[model samples]
Target: MTVVEVLFLLLGLVAAGSALLVVTTRTMVHAALWLVVTLGAVAGIFLLLAAEFVAWVQILIYVGAVVVLLLFALMLTKAPTGPQPDLDARRALPAVAVAGLVLAVLGTTVVAGFHGVELDLDGAVVGSAQTTGATIFQQWVLPFEVLSVLLLAALVGAIVLSRGTGRRGGE
Candidate 1:
Protein backbone atom coordinates (compact mmCIF):
# COMPACT_ATOMS: atom_id res chain seq x y z
CA MET A 1 0.00 0.00 0.00
CA THR A 2 2.75 2.46 0.99
CA VAL A 3 6.22 2.99 -0.44
CA VAL A 4 7.81 1.71 2.74
CA GLU A 5 5.64 -1.39 2.58
CA VAL A 6 6.65 -1.95 -1.02
CA LEU A 7 10.31 -1.63 -0.17
CA PHE A 8 9.92 -3.94 2.78
CA LEU A 9 8.21 -6.52 0.61
CA LEU A 10 10.98 -6.31 -1.97
CA LEU A 11 13.66 -6.71 0.66
CA GLY A 12 11.80 -9.61 2.20
CA LEU A 13 11.66 -11.34 -1.15
CA VAL A 14 15.38 -10.80 -1.67
CA ALA A 15 16.18 -12.13 1.78
CA ALA A 16 13.99 -15.18 1.36
CA GLY A 17 15.29 -16.01 -2.11
CA SER A 18 18.91 -15.60 -1.08
CA ALA A 19 18.31 -17.72 1.99
CA LEU A 20 16.89 -20.45 -0.16
CA LEU A 21 19.89 -20.25 -2.45
CA VAL A 22 22.17 -20.43 0.56
CA VAL A 23 20.76 -23.81 1.49
CA THR A 24 20.30 -25.23 -1.98
CA THR A 25 23.49 -24.24 -3.75
CA ARG A 26 25.88 -27.10 -4.39
CA THR A 27 29.00 -24.95 -4.16
CA MET A 28 30.14 -24.18 -0.65
CA VAL A 29 31.65 -20.83 -1.51
CA HIS A 30 28.58 -19.83 -3.48
CA ALA A 31 26.41 -20.79 -0.54
CA ALA A 32 28.45 -18.60 1.77
CA LEU A 33 28.20 -15.74 -0.72
CA TRP A 34 24.46 -16.22 -0.95
CA LEU A 35 24.30 -16.12 2.83
CA VAL A 36 26.03 -12.77 2.70
CA VAL A 37 23.42 -11.50 0.30
CA THR A 38 20.65 -12.76 2.54
CA LEU A 39 22.22 -11.07 5.54
CA GLY A 40 22.65 -7.84 3.60
CA ALA A 41 18.98 -7.95 2.66
CA VAL A 42 18.09 -8.47 6.29
CA ALA A 43 20.21 -5.47 7.19
CA GLY A 44 18.37 -3.47 4.59
CA ILE A 45 15.11 -4.52 6.21
CA PHE A 46 16.41 -3.34 9.57
CA LEU A 47 17.34 -0.02 8.04
CA LEU A 48 13.84 0.27 6.58
CA LEU A 49 12.48 -0.34 10.07
CA ALA A 50 14.55 2.62 11.32
CA ALA A 51 16.95 0.41 13.27
CA GLU A 52 20.23 1.87 12.09
CA PHE A 53 22.38 0.26 14.75
CA VAL A 54 20.97 -3.18 14.07
CA ALA A 55 21.38 -2.76 10.33
CA TRP A 56 25.04 -1.84 10.67
CA VAL A 57 25.65 -4.61 13.15
CA GLN A 58 24.00 -7.08 10.79
CA ILE A 59 26.23 -5.90 7.98
CA LEU A 60 29.40 -5.78 10.06
CA ILE A 61 29.01 -8.93 12.11
CA TYR A 62 27.26 -11.20 9.66
CA VAL A 63 28.17 -10.02 6.18
CA GLY A 64 31.63 -8.75 7.05
CA ALA A 65 32.97 -11.01 9.79
CA VAL A 66 31.04 -14.25 9.57
CA VAL A 67 30.97 -14.58 5.78
CA VAL A 68 34.61 -13.62 5.50
CA LEU A 69 35.45 -16.18 8.14
CA LEU A 70 33.50 -18.79 6.23
CA LEU A 71 35.25 -17.91 2.98
CA PHE A 72 38.61 -17.95 4.71
CA ALA A 73 37.95 -21.32 6.19
CA LEU A 74 36.86 -22.65 2.84
CA MET A 75 40.03 -21.42 1.22
CA LEU A 76 42.28 -22.58 4.04
CA THR A 77 40.81 -26.04 3.96
CA LYS A 78 41.22 -26.28 0.18
CA ALA A 79 37.56 -26.91 -0.25
CA PRO A 80 36.11 -27.62 -3.67
CA THR A 81 35.57 -24.48 -5.70
CA GLY A 82 32.88 -25.91 -7.97
CA PRO A 83 29.56 -27.63 -7.46
CA GLN A 84 29.57 -30.67 -5.22
CA PRO A 85 28.55 -34.00 -6.63
CA ASP A 86 27.43 -35.65 -3.41
CA LEU A 87 24.87 -33.11 -2.37
CA ASP A 88 21.81 -34.94 -1.19
CA ALA A 89 18.34 -33.82 -2.14
CA ARG A 90 16.51 -36.51 -0.21
CA ARG A 91 15.71 -34.24 2.74
CA ALA A 92 14.26 -31.44 0.63
CA LEU A 93 10.63 -32.42 1.11
CA PRO A 94 10.86 -32.71 4.87
CA ALA A 95 12.90 -29.55 5.14
CA VAL A 96 10.36 -27.63 3.05
CA ALA A 97 7.50 -28.91 5.17
CA VAL A 98 9.19 -27.84 8.38
CA ALA A 99 10.12 -24.48 6.95
CA GLY A 100 6.57 -23.90 5.79
CA LEU A 101 5.20 -24.83 9.19
CA VAL A 102 7.57 -22.48 11.00
CA LEU A 103 6.80 -19.67 8.59
CA ALA A 104 3.09 -20.18 9.02
CA VAL A 105 3.32 -20.13 12.81
CA LEU A 106 5.53 -17.04 12.85
CA GLY A 107 3.26 -15.27 10.35
CA THR A 108 0.22 -16.07 12.41
CA THR A 109 1.86 -14.84 15.60
CA VAL A 110 3.03 -11.58 14.04
CA VAL A 111 -0.34 -10.83 12.46
CA ALA A 112 -2.19 -11.58 15.66
CA GLY A 113 0.19 -9.60 17.82
CA PHE A 114 0.23 -6.50 15.64
CA HIS A 115 -3.21 -6.59 14.12
CA GLY A 116 -4.12 -3.13 12.81
CA VAL A 117 -1.35 -1.60 14.94
CA GLU A 118 0.64 1.33 13.60
CA LEU A 119 4.12 2.15 14.80
CA ASP A 120 4.98 5.75 15.71
CA LEU A 121 8.56 6.26 14.60
CA ASP A 122 8.75 9.95 15.49
CA GLY A 123 11.23 10.64 18.29
CA ALA A 124 11.92 6.91 18.69
CA VAL A 125 15.42 6.34 20.05
CA VAL A 126 15.29 2.62 20.74
CA GLY A 127 17.61 1.61 17.90
CA SER A 128 20.19 4.30 18.35
CA ALA A 129 23.85 3.36 18.74
CA GLN A 130 23.99 4.80 22.25
CA THR A 131 21.01 2.79 23.41
CA THR A 132 22.25 -0.41 21.75
CA GLY A 133 25.78 -0.04 23.08
CA ALA A 134 24.59 0.59 26.61
CA THR A 135 22.26 -2.38 26.51
CA ILE A 136 24.98 -4.66 25.12
CA PHE A 137 27.62 -3.59 27.60
CA GLN A 138 25.37 -3.45 30.61
CA GLN A 139 23.19 -6.46 30.05
CA TRP A 140 24.96 -8.74 27.56
CA VAL A 141 28.63 -8.27 28.31
CA LEU A 142 29.32 -11.74 29.62
CA PRO A 143 27.49 -13.58 26.88
CA PHE A 144 29.09 -11.39 24.26
CA GLU A 145 32.55 -12.07 25.62
CA VAL A 146 31.83 -15.77 25.82
CA LEU A 147 30.66 -15.79 22.22
CA SER A 148 33.81 -14.04 21.11
CA VAL A 149 35.94 -16.59 22.87
CA LEU A 150 33.91 -19.40 21.32
CA LEU A 151 34.38 -17.98 17.84
CA LEU A 152 38.09 -17.65 18.40
CA ALA A 153 38.28 -21.22 19.57
CA ALA A 154 36.39 -22.40 16.53
CA LEU A 155 38.75 -20.54 14.22
CA VAL A 156 41.74 -22.10 15.94
CA GLY A 157 40.13 -25.50 15.66
CA ALA A 158 39.51 -25.08 11.96
CA ILE A 159 43.11 -24.09 11.41
CA VAL A 160 44.33 -27.08 13.36
CA LEU A 161 42.09 -29.43 11.43
CA SER A 162 43.31 -28.02 8.13
CA ARG A 163 46.99 -28.21 9.04
CA GLY A 164 46.84 -31.80 10.29
CA THR A 165 49.83 -32.68 12.53
CA GLY A 166 52.26 -30.28 10.79
CA ARG A 167 54.50 -33.01 9.41
CA ARG A 168 56.23 -32.13 6.14
CA GLY A 169 58.86 -33.62 3.81
CA GLY A 170 58.14 -37.09 5.25
CA GLU A 171 59.54 -36.05 8.60
Candidate 2:
Protein backbone atom coordinates (compact mmCIF):
# COMPACT_ATOMS: atom_id res chain seq x y z
CA MET A 1 0.00 0.00 0.00
CA THR A 2 1.02 3.61 -0.49
CA VAL A 3 1.94 6.05 2.27
CA VAL A 4 -1.36 7.85 1.88
CA GLU A 5 -3.22 4.57 2.16
CA VAL A 6 -1.38 3.75 5.37
CA LEU A 7 -2.15 7.17 6.83
CA PHE A 8 -5.78 6.83 5.85
CA LEU A 9 -6.02 3.45 7.51
CA LEU A 10 -4.43 4.80 10.67
CA LEU A 11 -6.79 7.71 10.80
CA GLY A 12 -9.77 5.42 10.25
CA LEU A 13 -8.65 3.26 13.13
CA VAL A 14 -8.26 6.30 15.34
CA ALA A 15 -11.69 7.56 14.35
CA ALA A 16 -13.32 4.20 15.00
CA GLY A 17 -11.65 3.81 18.39
CA SER A 18 -12.64 7.25 19.56
CA ALA A 19 -16.16 6.81 18.28
CA LEU A 20 -16.50 3.69 20.39
CA LEU A 21 -15.21 5.62 23.37
CA VAL A 22 -17.70 8.38 22.70
CA VAL A 23 -20.60 5.97 23.04
CA THR A 24 -19.29 4.00 25.97
CA THR A 25 -17.87 6.71 28.23
CA ARG A 26 -19.78 7.33 31.44
CA THR A 27 -18.95 11.00 31.79
CA MET A 28 -20.57 13.52 29.45
CA VAL A 29 -17.42 15.64 29.26
CA HIS A 30 -15.20 12.68 28.36
CA ALA A 31 -17.63 11.60 25.68
CA ALA A 32 -17.60 15.08 24.15
CA LEU A 33 -13.81 15.14 24.22
CA TRP A 34 -13.61 11.77 22.53
CA LEU A 35 -16.05 13.02 19.93
CA VAL A 36 -13.61 15.82 19.15
CA VAL A 37 -10.84 13.27 18.64
CA THR A 38 -13.07 11.18 16.39
CA LEU A 39 -14.05 14.21 14.30
CA GLY A 40 -10.41 15.31 14.00
CA ALA A 41 -9.48 11.88 12.74
CA VAL A 42 -12.26 12.05 10.16
CA ALA A 43 -10.94 15.43 8.99
CA GLY A 44 -7.47 13.91 8.65
CA ILE A 45 -8.94 11.17 6.49
CA PHE A 46 -10.55 13.83 4.30
CA LEU A 47 -7.18 15.54 3.96
CA LEU A 48 -5.64 12.23 2.84
CA LEU A 49 -8.38 11.96 0.21
CA ALA A 50 -7.16 15.34 -1.19
CA ALA A 51 -10.32 17.17 -0.15
CA GLU A 52 -8.66 20.12 1.51
CA PHE A 53 -11.69 22.36 1.65
CA VAL A 54 -13.86 19.60 3.06
CA ALA A 55 -11.20 18.74 5.65
CA TRP A 56 -10.96 22.33 6.83
CA VAL A 57 -14.71 22.59 6.89
CA GLN A 58 -14.90 19.46 9.01
CA ILE A 59 -12.32 20.80 11.44
CA LEU A 60 -13.81 24.23 11.74
CA ILE A 61 -17.44 23.19 11.88
CA TYR A 62 -17.28 19.95 13.85
CA VAL A 63 -14.17 20.09 15.97
CA GLY A 64 -14.19 23.84 16.62
CA ALA A 65 -17.88 24.68 16.84
CA VAL A 66 -19.99 21.62 17.61
CA VAL A 67 -17.78 20.04 20.24
CA VAL A 68 -17.22 23.37 21.96
CA LEU A 69 -20.95 23.94 22.06
CA LEU A 70 -21.46 20.44 23.48
CA LEU A 71 -18.88 21.10 26.18
CA PHE A 72 -20.53 24.37 27.06
CA ALA A 73 -23.87 22.68 27.35
CA LEU A 74 -22.42 20.05 29.63
CA MET A 75 -20.87 22.71 31.85
CA LEU A 76 -24.01 24.77 31.98
CA THR A 77 -26.20 21.79 32.78
CA LYS A 78 -24.00 20.79 35.73
CA ALA A 79 -24.30 17.13 34.82
CA PRO A 80 -23.13 14.54 37.30
CA THR A 81 -19.38 14.08 37.36
CA GLY A 82 -19.33 10.59 38.84
CA PRO A 83 -19.49 7.29 37.05
CA GLN A 84 -22.94 6.62 35.63
CA PRO A 85 -24.04 3.07 36.31
CA ASP A 86 -26.59 2.97 33.51
CA LEU A 87 -24.07 4.08 30.90
CA ASP A 88 -21.30 1.75 32.10
CA ALA A 89 -23.38 -1.38 32.46
CA ARG A 90 -23.50 -4.21 29.91
CA ARG A 91 -21.25 -2.50 27.40
CA ALA A 92 -20.24 -5.68 25.65
CA LEU A 93 -23.25 -7.61 24.38
CA PRO A 94 -25.75 -4.92 23.38
CA ALA A 95 -23.17 -2.50 22.07
CA VAL A 96 -21.63 -5.16 19.86
CA ALA A 97 -25.03 -6.16 18.48
CA VAL A 98 -26.04 -2.60 17.64
CA ALA A 99 -22.68 -1.78 16.09
CA GLY A 100 -22.75 -4.93 13.97
CA LEU A 101 -26.26 -4.16 12.74
CA VAL A 102 -25.29 -0.61 11.79
CA LEU A 103 -22.15 -1.78 10.03
CA ALA A 104 -24.07 -4.35 8.04
CA VAL A 105 -26.71 -1.85 6.92
CA LEU A 106 -24.18 0.83 5.96
CA GLY A 107 -21.87 -1.61 4.22
CA THR A 108 -24.70 -3.09 2.22
CA THR A 109 -25.93 0.37 1.19
CA VAL A 110 -22.47 1.50 0.05
CA VAL A 111 -21.89 -1.68 -1.93
CA ALA A 112 -25.27 -1.43 -3.61
CA GLY A 113 -24.99 2.28 -4.38
CA PHE A 114 -21.42 2.26 -5.75
CA HIS A 115 -21.24 -1.27 -7.05
CA GLY A 116 -19.18 -0.54 -10.18
CA VAL A 117 -18.25 3.10 -9.69
CA GLU A 118 -14.54 3.81 -9.32
CA LEU A 119 -13.09 6.76 -7.50
CA ASP A 120 -10.41 8.57 -9.46
CA LEU A 121 -8.15 10.13 -6.86
CA ASP A 122 -5.46 11.20 -9.31
CA GLY A 123 -7.41 14.00 -10.97
CA ALA A 124 -6.83 17.53 -9.77
CA VAL A 125 -9.87 19.25 -8.32
CA VAL A 126 -10.51 22.57 -10.13
CA GLY A 127 -14.01 23.59 -9.15
CA SER A 128 -14.84 27.23 -8.48
CA ALA A 129 -15.85 28.40 -5.02
CA GLN A 130 -19.48 28.75 -5.95
CA THR A 131 -19.70 25.24 -7.35
CA THR A 132 -17.98 23.73 -4.34
CA GLY A 133 -20.07 25.72 -1.91
CA ALA A 134 -23.28 24.74 -3.62
CA THR A 135 -22.29 21.08 -3.73
CA ILE A 136 -21.44 21.06 -0.05
CA PHE A 137 -24.66 22.76 0.96
CA GLN A 138 -26.72 20.50 -1.21
CA GLN A 139 -25.18 17.29 0.01
CA TRP A 140 -24.77 18.29 3.65
CA VAL A 141 -27.95 20.21 4.31
CA LEU A 142 -29.65 17.42 6.26
CA PRO A 143 -26.72 16.72 8.56
CA PHE A 144 -26.04 20.41 9.14
CA GLU A 145 -29.64 21.09 10.04
CA VAL A 146 -29.80 18.05 12.28
CA LEU A 147 -26.74 19.23 14.16
CA SER A 148 -28.18 22.69 14.50
CA VAL A 149 -31.33 21.31 16.03
CA LEU A 150 -29.33 19.07 18.38
CA LEU A 151 -27.21 21.99 19.55
CA LEU A 152 -30.26 24.12 20.07
CA ALA A 153 -31.83 21.37 22.12
CA ALA A 154 -28.74 21.12 24.27
CA LEU A 155 -28.75 24.86 24.86
CA VAL A 156 -32.40 24.77 25.87
CA GLY A 157 -31.80 21.85 28.21
CA ALA A 158 -28.94 23.71 29.83
CA ILE A 159 -31.12 26.72 30.39
CA VAL A 160 -33.83 24.60 31.93
CA LEU A 161 -31.45 22.82 34.28
CA SER A 162 -29.76 26.03 35.34
CA ARG A 163 -33.12 27.58 36.13
CA GLY A 164 -34.07 24.60 38.22
CA THR A 165 -30.94 25.03 40.32
CA GLY A 166 -31.50 28.76 40.61
CA ARG A 167 -35.08 28.33 41.88
CA ARG A 168 -34.06 25.59 44.30
CA GLY A 169 -31.42 27.88 45.78
CA GLY A 170 -33.97 30.73 45.94
CA GLU A 171 -31.78 32.93 43.79
| Best model number under lDDT | 1
Q: Per-residue alpha-carbon lDDT of model 2 for 35-128, expressed as tens digits?
A: 9999999988887777777788898999999999898888888878776768665557897899799999999999999999966667657344
Model 1: CA > 4 A from native:
137-171
Error of 1 at 53 (Å): 1.6
Best TM-score among the predictions, by candidate number: 1
Clashing pairs for predicted structure model 2, backbone only: none
TM-score of each: 0.74, 0.66
Cα lDDT listed for each candidate:
0.89, 0.84
**Candidate 1 local lDDT, 1-171, one digit each (tens):** 778789989999999999999988899999999999899999998988889999998899998898998999899889999899777576579988998999999999999999999976556665779888999899999999999999899989887777757664586
Clashes of each: 0, 0
